[model samples]
Target: MACVTGKNSKPKSMSKAKEWTVEVENLFRFQQAGYRDELEYIQVKQGALIERWPDTGYVKKLQRRDDTFFYYSRKRECQDFEVHKVKVYAY
Candidate 1:
């Protein structure tokens, strides 16, 4: 829980931002699969990524062809990019 002050300088009850743990169910790496480039197949758990604005859902999977890769995310904006720990989640 987080405390937020309103315009009247009074404390308001508010719930903190929900934090989610992300896990990659399967990751396949193919060597020389692309045009002299490596290719990867990433499959994440369903409903792992949470969308806060505009929409709300989870990223199911990612598709890659040649040098172009299509990714689906729940978040509308990008703040910072980084990688964290990955755990296998049973669907």
Candidate 2:
């Protein structure tokens, strides 16, 4: 969906995720797409729509920096072992 761009859209701090959660999972997807997080994606894209699953509210699709799309399942895609690789951005 379209996001509102504002002064606080940029993340002030970031850290590696220590656990698996819906938010973390989404961040992982953004990371895979070469973005630090959703906020950065929105900023770079000028508020591009982010497709999401209706039922689970998980990321359904993402456009990478190369202009290619990456589709994700409604279920959790970030395994337990990969949680640490996800970066959580603080706005």
**What is the C-alpha local distance difference test score of each model?**
0.25, 0.82
lDDT of 2 by residue, 1-91 (tens): 2244574566666788898888888888888888887777777787899999999888889888889999999999899999998877666
Overall local distance difference test of candidate 2:
0.82
Candidate 2 TM-score over all chains jointly = 0.84
What TM-score, over all chains together, does every model reach? 0.17, 0.84
Q: Which regions of candidate 1 are displaced past 4 Å?
A: 1-20, 25-63, 76-91
Q: Candidate 1 has what TM-score?
A: 0.17
Best by TM-score: 2
Backbone clashes counted, model 1: 0
* Model 2 weakest 10-residue run by lDDT: 1-10
